[model samples]
Structures are given as structure tokens and as C-alpha cells.
Target: MVAALLAAVSVAADPATTASAGEQGAWFSDPVVVSGQNTAEPGIEVAPDGRLYVNAPAGLLADLPGAASFLWRSDDGGATWVLTPPGLRAAFPGGGDSDVAVDPQGATVYFSDLWVGSSTAAVSDDRGNSWFASPLSGVVIHDRQWLATSGGGVVYLAYNQIPAGVMVSKSVDGGRTFVVHSLAASVLDRSGCVCPPGTMVVEEGTGPAGLADRVGVVYATSTGGVGFARSVDGGLTFAQVTVAPARDGIDTTRAFPVVANAGPGQLVAVWQEVVEGQRTRVQFSGSADWGRSWSDPQVVVDAGTPLFPWVDANGGGKVGVSLYHTDQATLPDAAPDDAVWFERYLESLDGGQTFSPLVTVDPTPVKTGPICTQGAACAQDRELLDFQAVAIDTDGLALLTWARSIDNVADTEIRFARQLTDEATTAAPTLHLHDAVGDAITRPLPWLFRTATWSPTGR
Candidate 1:
């Protein structure tokens, strides 16, 4: 099935001819500005029809003060965007974090917002022209509600309500109602900062894990390192599987799990953790038989500390992970106020076996600050909401969005970038030194002999 899908629209890049130099250098489009200022916690969704929706809790200059959330809609991919009215805040008092999801069948858009201690969502059937907002029935989602929609319009939301365990909710009738299920009995600590929220997805078909048509969820636990749950019978019943065992007496909030279905039955999950008391690293695990079991966790990237790791998988065997790594050599000073942070992305074409070198998405470190200012000096803190977002289209183009300070640390703004999955073209190949090893290294070179061309999958 994966082969069939890839073969259907696969393009054989011209073998690096002299005339193909410019096209070969076009592996990725230049950074496209998604929003100008005053927005954080950017949640983006790309519809099957090529529409783009980005949502944030607050800070959008276009939105009123009481407006709970701000939305930006783009019809021609991400080239141009317009603000959707601030109706979401009218539904919830005092804004919190929010995320967006879309139903492919009807182009129905679902936007979930956390506010005033409860999680609520809005639905848009006619793209972003209009919306219907309401509170989720089954659970009072306390933290970030990461929503995922199945092809059949089945919406799954995963959240963490401290002292009540991590929960997964299902909404079959669009975003109108929900059925919540508890995957864990208790969180690591009700008082500790909210453990990073869990992530959920409905398998496309029989998953690589051998579980056909199952709804799977992966979450971070205070007591347990990482937990997995799946409902083979839709959203009715669920059983747990151990992905990563808990570290004795260690806080698990540092380990936020992000899961995605790569292809037919293939699953990939990534997160971050504080290991050996001082070092922090991004951990990855995969399941080929659904959520029943998982492979041993492995470190994918490590700097001084990696945070807010986000993961997404393409229908082909490609997986992309994005996170920011900061170098903090001293304790207590762990969250460096003047640190040079690398907003990096790593890609894997053959599942998780190997990953491309860290790809810096931001032109410069967050330390470079803002290019413009909106309000008072932006608070010098690790802020970008909970996590950034990444999505891949049928054409194998990866769209990534994140919030960053505009001028050093003056204002917040949302940024977007595109990367080609099949291959990244370059006028010519480049070189790099071996890390500490003297031998030069060059493998998996996609641009050496080929250039990527577009072929609509008609997905």
C-alpha cells in the first residue's frame, strides 16, 4: 500500500543535468512569514484540499483582548493568510493554550482551546467561514488537548488532568460531544507543573503494530516514564502497553510523548527526558504491531538540553522531529537567559534507523531576538506555549511552524518553513567536518544525482 501510494505520484528527479542546477537547489522554500507579531503556542493544520489553519491562545494583534484565541487562514497554501474573527474567545472566558485539527472527508476544521480550567472546542464545516463552539462533554480537559481526526471523521483528544490520570476522549459527531477514557489512574503529581499532555491518533487501517483499526494514545507519566494505550474496538475499551519504564523516583513531566502513524501499520513516537540527573536527550521508540508493544527507546539528539520535541511521519517511510536544544553547562543556570538555542529538525527516511544531520529551521538562534517589537520587552523565559507543530502533505512537503521572539527578546511571532521529504535539491553537494572524528563523513546524499519535482498524489 505504501509503495503503491508513493509510486502513484513519484517523480524521478532529472539526473543533475547542467540545466537542473537551479531546480536542484530548490530542496526547500525560503522561510515564509505566517504571522507578524503577538502570537505564541502556534497550532497549525494543513487540510487535504491545501488549506492552512493556524491557531493560538492570545497575543494576536488582530484579536481583541477578551478574545480567547486567534486564527489565521490561508487558502493558497501558506503564501498568503487572513485572520479569522476572534469568535473562539467569545466561547471561553480568559484564553489558554489551543490546537487545531481537521477532518479530511468534509474539510471540517476543529479547534480545541483550554481556558478557565476547562477544555472546549469549535467546529467549522465550511472551511473557516463559520464555526460552532461548545465545551467537551465527557472530560474537563485541564491541560493541552492535542486533537487528532481519523479519515472517517472520528476525533480523538488526549489530555492530562492531574490527580485524575491521563485521559483520551473521542468525539464522533464532529466536535459536539465526547467519550473520555482514563489511561492511567493517577498523574505523577497533582501539584507539579502539568505533566506534558499525551498524544493520540486513529490508525489508518490495520496498524504496523498488527492492530487493525485501533485508536492509540501515548502519554508521559509522573511515576511511569511513558505509557501507551489502544482501543481496538474504536473508543470503547483500552489496554495499556509499556513503551518506556519509569525512572525510580524521577519526575516524568520532562518526558512528553508525541506519536504518529508513519505508514501502513507503522508507528513512531518521540519525547525528551532528563537522564543521569544532568543530561537531557530526545528519546524515540517505534511499534510495528500497533500499540501492543514498543521498541527500546534510543537517543536521537542531545545538546545541553532538548525541549518541546515535536514529531510527524509521512505516508512514505519518512519521519520528522523538531526541537530546540540549549547549551547550559551550569546547574540552576540550566534555563540560560542568554543562551544560544538551536531550533533544529531531524529527518529519517527509512523509519528511525538513521536521521539527517540537525537541520536548523530558524535563520538564527532565539538569542538573535526579535526583528520588531509589539508590547513591552518580551519576558525572558522559555516560552512558546507547550510545543510547536509539524505536518506533511501528500506531496511530501513538510510544513513546520513555531513561535519565536522577533528582535532578540522584544516580541513574539509565528514562523513557517517547508522541507521536501522525497529529496532536497541543491545546486551542488556540500561538505562538513566529522564531529571530533577526523574522517570526513558523507552518506545518504540525496542531492548528488537528483532533484525533487512535484507530482500530485491526488490523495
Candidate 2:
């Protein structure tokens, strides 16, 4: 019965061809709800085999014994998905935060879950069929943990160690166990904002000679800036550098910065900064020489207040960023009744040199109420959670997954939007939604299944 229920919940949607009024370019397929259970703070990654893996707090499945989080796998790109529960919550049953990472060869997939004072990294060798868990050491308190993998058996995990700043752990035996490698940042360097480290990446050392594979991470700095820490010696020691300096009125406590490796030593970082205490804007800076030097920060989007900025790059200067955006100039707490928030995306074909105009990935409003930035302490309306994720797929198109609030009910579900390419429009894949037991689910179609004319724009 449980398997049938899970199978019944699996759903797939055809790409909507007609662009809405405000959605002029129609660069992305219409948003599709991928999770039937309540889940938020989604993390996404595209495997080498073109499979999409997403992890989030188990939500409704929290009561299931040992169920830490839900791993949603999409074998047919983003059209259909299947949920696999990772029963890795022996220590902390109530899952806190979760992240997903795929190794280079796509043979090993890593999912890290955070508990109250500890965390677990679960490894799946056969995709998401089964997973073995391993505890992460080197941190007294674990908050938000992120995983990154390189060639060989190397895996790096970074998380917030509370007042002690961000700490990193390394796994040499294919994530079987992790040992403390080094501190990405100490308390002295940060402003005491228990902000978790942003998306971590392993540069494959394809740059200049003598440049070994470098592991890099970005975090909030003490002076409302973005601090980057990189280790070339395999996490033994790290050198920290400032990608962006302090801005006078910017708030570092809520500003989380994210970094992505464009190619070799080329890196790009993006963060949100409050302006005049009224609104927030997204800004980005690029580093051509690893983390040693950074370009002056430039505004990526200034029309409205943006939150939870995430950046991902796919080599050769191709970069993508996703964020929760609202046209209201006021903070989320002060949003008016008509204020609506949507998932907005921007692309850069030439690294961070220039960005395309902001494209609304989803026509649906993700949230309509005050979005509390206070983590874990918020009393109401915290459904959207901390961040949404964007990953460049094997086809070099953007794939985005985020949480959408359910009619201001304080509950949220995962939604996915895929960038539409010329090939995708001509040959739309048949939709296939399945249940946990791999049974197909058939249902009446909606407008999402309707076909219309769509032209590739600005690709």
C-alpha cells in the first residue's frame, strides 16, 4: 500500500509552449511540482548520465524510522521523478538541512543531512536505490553541511561549526568516513552569523601548470563581504581571500555568498546585499586567478529585492544564477498584498563578464507573504526556507529546483523548472510519472500538457 501511494504521487508534466504575458522569452519550461510531501530548502545536481538528483528534509516522512531525507531522482531528465528515502537519521531523526553531490564519474552519489549537533553523509553507489551512511567528524556543532566530490575517492564536506565559523571535512575512501581537514574560516574572520558555507566545488586543476585540483568554498565575512577559502594541497591547509569587501550598510548576518568554478582558476561568487535598509540586490564578482584576486563587484539584478542567490558554472564562461525575486522594493516582511515572488534566473555566456536580462523561470508565485530570514527561530511563514538551487545539466542547459509555498499555508513542496532548448521544443519527451515501486501513474492532463509554438530565444 505504501508503495502504491508513493507510485500514485509520481507525476510528470509536458513543457508549456505558450508564454504568459510577463513571460516574454519563455526560456524555461513551466514549473512542475516534483514532491508530494512537504519539503523545503532543496539542493539539486545533474549527474554525468543526465540524471537529476535532489535532496531535502524528509518533511512528512520524518516519522518513518531512520528516514532522514528524501532523494528525488529523475532518470528522464526533469520530466519525471522518483523519491528514495535515505534512512540515515539514526542519531538525529528530525532532519535539519540536506545537500546532494554527484561524483565526476557519477558512480558515487553523496547526500549529507544535518541534525542538532551532528550530521551524516550517505553514499549511494547504485544511484538512489540504496545508501550506506557515515558520520562526519571535526565539528562540535553541525548546522548546514554541503558536499563536493572530485576525481578518485576524494569528497569534501563544509558546514557551519556554530560560533567557531565554517569547518571542512575530507573523505578519501569514497565517503566511507570523513576526518577533519581544516577550518575554512574561524570566528575571528566572520561576523558571528551562523550562516552555512555556500555551494562547494572542486576545480579539476585544468588551469596553469603546478596548479593541483583546488577545493574552494565561499562564506559570509565579518564586514558584510564574501570570503573565499581554497585548498590546493588536498584540504590539508587553506588560504582565505576576500572576494568582496565590506559595504557600509549591508547586513552580513543574512547575506550568504555562493561560489562556482567556471574553469580551472576561474571562479564566480554571488551574494545578496541590502540597500538603504529598504531593498536587496544581487551582486557578483569573478576571480580569474583562483581566489587570489577578484574583480570589482557588479550588480546582477537591482529591480527588486532578491533572496537566496545561487550560482553555478559549466566551463567556457557559461554561468547561471537562481534566486527568489520580488518586484517590491520593500523587504519581504513589508511586502504588500499584491506582492509576489518568483524564481528568477540569469545566464552569462562569457563567465561573469555580462549577464542576460533576468528571466522568470516559473510563472507561479513561489511565496506571497513575509519571508523570514531568521533561521530556525521564525515563528511564521518560513516555508520557502533558506535557498533554492540551480545546476547546469550535461546538455549545458540550466536546471532549477526550489520550494514553493502552498497558498500561504506555511507548507511547501519542491518544484522544478528546466531551461528549454531548441532540441527540446521540437521533440518533447513523453511524460512519465512513477511511484516509489516504479509503477506508472496516469491522470488527466492539464494545460501543462498542451502543446503550442515555442521558439528558442537568445540561446
Candidate 3:
């Protein structure tokens, strides 16, 4: 143990801290924003020690630059971060899109990187300290999904570059190699985009507390309908299940799914579905026997237009979820349909059989400026916005990080709300943090694709 340390430094609340005493959901005191670096891509992870470790991409990190273009770790968790000696950036010269993953035991860490213009992989052994770059034999240009590692094993999600199908690969003897397999094994091309085969998409992880496939599921949309597939053999193979069965010739796209494996065979999955000209709904489905069958789809958000369905790793045998939506109807892609919406930062207290709606993740008065539909020019809009990650504070309190930024620069400050809610039951529906916070996070960091993990396995 390094004895958990923080050097002596001056501390004061920056005046930009906003406090709302009258709002129904505001319980923020004097919260502070921890400023970050400009170059490294920032993402937070909770270590086995129950502290936050923030991974930042290459270039002599402000604190630490463990590996190459990859990420670093923080012993004091996110409170204080550092860079290790050998890094992920040094390992993968073909670096492109990089993602972080922790072992099932939480004792090891993994960094997954993509090759530029393609779907190649390079991974880290340590928590970002060092890594090895291995060519994933047959894989061409697939996208990176949630990365998982257990002891020397490695698993990942990827989509076909053409037909837009889903695929997953695994390296049983660590990330040195892989066994590739196609998921959602359906033959569906794009919606008339004369492209080659299409690729699949993946999501963040829910650790061991999450469902069978962890947090990765493959959904394919075709002239037929949208179908679902999940991997249990560490992503080496997948079994299909229909998420949105064919009804209207309408198709399903962007079906983000997350699961929680309650027990040996009990699993639960949730995803979002859109009806072209109608509403998008978030629904929950469960299976008591490992992917053998699923429960009747329960519409979690039936009254509103759902946009996203995200899940968090709930500590005590549960999973947390965030649902984003709007009730005020607007024509598809219409103007100013914008509104500060509410969400249920829910937790499956009984492992998916029940839920508790917690406080709103996104703050009130709106988080960021309206969506910029101007395409390429939208990235140029620098504006003050809100952004934060969820942290488990106490037994009943969840820490929601809230901050503001403008022009991708720090215009305001960051603040967090300590949500005091009942952990035993489903919390109430609250707001989600979707109003594009800072342009910085969404900004592209081409140089960061090479960083790795920083734990002991880097050796």
C-alpha cells in the first residue's frame, strides 16, 4: 500500500458552483470540479479497492502516462491519478479507437485499441502500465466494444464492416491471440447504402453483476426486422433471440442492450426500439435459463420517446440503468423539440425482477445547448454544457458528477449531487445527463488510440 496520499494544496470552491435549493431534485452543496488534462482522453473506472481510477490517453500525461497512446491508473482512484512507465500508446502504433476493461475479479485491467481505418486489436496486461500488440488474424475493420478479461482470458465485441452484422472474439490465453465468431449471424445489409459488409456496435460493461454477455449485445436491422443475439462463451459464440420481432415493415436501429446475470442461469436484458415515424421505446426482457427463453417484453418507457438505454454496474448483485427521453411530441428531426427531460436512474434491486428509480443524472435548467443538426459544422460549436459520471457514494447515496463547459473549454465549474435514496426499492424516475456537456469529451483525439492498462499483468 502506498499509504493513500494527497500532497498539501490550497483548496477553495470555484464561484461557478450552482446550487438549487427549491428544485424538487436538487440536493447539491459546495461541490467541486476536478479539472482534467487537454490531450488525454478521459474515462473513469472503479478499482477493486473501491476507488475511481481515471484513464487518460498518451503524451506525457499531466499525472501519469503509463503506456503508449492508451490509458493510466489512479491509486487514489479518480481523486488523484498517475501514469505508469510502459504505456498502451507505445504498444499499438496502429492505434485508433481504444476502450478500457477490468477483469471479472477486478484484480487485472485491460486496454483494447483499434487499428486506424480498420478493426485490429492491441491490448494491455497491466492497468495501463504496459501491453502487447497482437494481430487478430482474420479480423479486418471491425468496431471495438466492451472488453473483458479474466485471468489470462480476453473477450471483445465487434461488428462486420459490410452487412452490418455482429461479431465477437476471445483470446483464452490472454490478449496475445483470438478466436473470432459472428454474432447475430444474420445476413442483413445496410438500408440501401451500397457499402460492403456492415459492422456491429458494442456498449459499456456491467462487470460480473451484469447479464450473461456482460454489457454487449448485437442487434441487426434488415428488410425483415431487428433480431438479437448474445454470447455466453466469453463472446466466442452467440445464440439468437428476437429483441424486436417483425411487426411493421419498420426497421430497428441503434438498439443498445445491457444485461445483468443474476445467478447461474438467470439473466436480464434491456434495449431500445424505434418505430421510424413513431416513438422509440425502452423495454426490459429476462431469461430464467441461460438464453433458453425470455420473458414477455416489458415496456419500461411506454409513454415517451426514448432515445438511449444505458446500464451501470450496481454493487450489490444488481445493475443500474439510465433511460433518456422526451414527452413533448415533435416530428422526426423537427426543430426545437428540445427539452430538459427526466429519466429513471434505476437499479434492479431484485436482479431485474424489480427496480428503484433514483435521482435524475442530468441537472436541471438544461445541461448543454440544443443539438446542432448542421453535421460537420456542429463540432465547432463551443458552448457551456453539463456532463458527469455516476459513482456509488454510500449505502444509499449515489454520487452524480455534474459540471459545465463552453467552447470545449472550462467556462463554468463541476459540481456533484449526493443523491440520498432508498437502495432496497426502485428509486423514482429522474433526469439523465444527455444535454451534450462539453465539446471537449466529444472532440476527437486521434493521438490517444494507443494507451493501455496499468495493473501488474503488464509484466
User: Which candidate's lDDT is highest?
Assistant: 2
TM-score of each: 0.78, 0.83, 0.62
Among these predicted structures, which one has the highest TM-score?
A: 2
**Per-residue error at 162 for model 2, in Å?**
3.0
For model 3, what is the C-alpha lDDT against the true structure? 0.40
Error of 1 at 45 (Å): 1.8
RMSD (CA, angstroms), candidate 3: 13.5
Q: Name the lDDT value of residue 450 in candidate 3.
A: 19
Give a tens-digit lDDT track for model 1, residues 203-231. 64434322244777777765537777777
Between the candidate structures 1 and 2, which one is better when assessed by lDDT? Answer: 2
**Which tens-of-lDDT digit does each residue in 393-431 have in candidate 3?**
224234444334323333433333334332233233332
lDDT computed for candidate 2: 0.71
Candidate 2 lDDT over 1-459, as tens digits, reads 111111112222222311111453377777778896787888898787777888888652265345477789987777778887554434434366777788886567887776646676778888878877865544657677788887566778888877777788887777778864578877776655556777676765543321356887888765677788888866667787887787777765574678887766677788887766778777787777777777767776667667888988866667798998777667865777677888888776656654555667888888885788877787877888788989887667788999998877667889987877543223323435444366775543221222343222213
